[model samples]
Target: MVTKTIEVVNAQGIHMRPAGMLVAEMKKFPNCNVTLKCGEKTAKATAVMQIMASGIKCGSKVEITAEGENEQAALDKAAELFETGFGE
Candidate 1:
């Protein structure tokens, strides 16, 4: 398992488009268990609605976790996506 920390940088946060993108990326790794969290709220990264509902405002700190054989790569990719501002 691996967990990486990042801050939301997209001006609009993780809105619908970015949330869908994140979910789609997450779904590519079936053996992984992914989780996204902001402060005390956490949800499965596989769920678009749950991620959007996080209300993770810009600059909010977030934790991305992945557990599986490919945990490190999964976490790294997620961190890269967030660090890139979700392609904003």
Candidate 2:
């Protein structure tokens, strides 16, 4: 498993558009399991609704975990997305 903690830099946080983008990207790693943790909330990276429901905000710190096949690649991609603020 691989993990990285990053801050949510997008002004809108992980809204519908970014959530959808995350889901789409994470889905590419079918063999890997991606999870996001923020405060007391935990969500599957590929679940848009769960991600939005986590209440992630601009300054929120998120812990991303990727396990199983291609875990590093999955983690790297997720980290990149967060670092880029989902291209907001």
Candidate 3:
């Protein structure tokens, strides 16, 4: 598994649009399993509802984990998105 932690930078946090975008991007890596962890909450990265429900706010630190084939790539992509504030 590949793992990385990033602080959300988007002003609005992981709302509908960003959650949808994250799910869309994660769906591309069929061979990998991606998950997000924030405090005591955890959610599947491919589930938009779960992501938004996690209440990950701006400046919140989230740990991303990707396992299986293409794990590294998947983690990298997630990190890029988080670092870029989901292109807000």
* Cα-based lDDT for every prediction: 0.88, 0.94, 0.94
lDDT of 3 at 53: 92
Query: Mind giving the per-residue lDDT tens digits that candidate 1 earns over 2-84?
Result: 89899999998889888888888888888999999898889788998888888888989999999986888878888888999
lDDT by residue (1-88, candidate 2, tens digit) is: 8899999999988899889999999999999999999999999999989999998999999999999999999999999999998888
- Tell me the spans in candidate 2 whose CA falls farther than 4 Å from its real position: none
Clashing pairs counted in every model: 0, 0, 0
- Model 2 lDDT, full chain set: 0.94
Q: Which residue runs of candidate 3 sit more than 4 Å off their true CA positions?
A: none
- State model 3's lDDT: 0.94
Q: How many backbone clashes does candidate 1 have?
A: 0
TM-score of 2: 0.97
The count of backbone overlaps in candidate 2 is 0
* Model 1 ranges off by over 4 Å: none
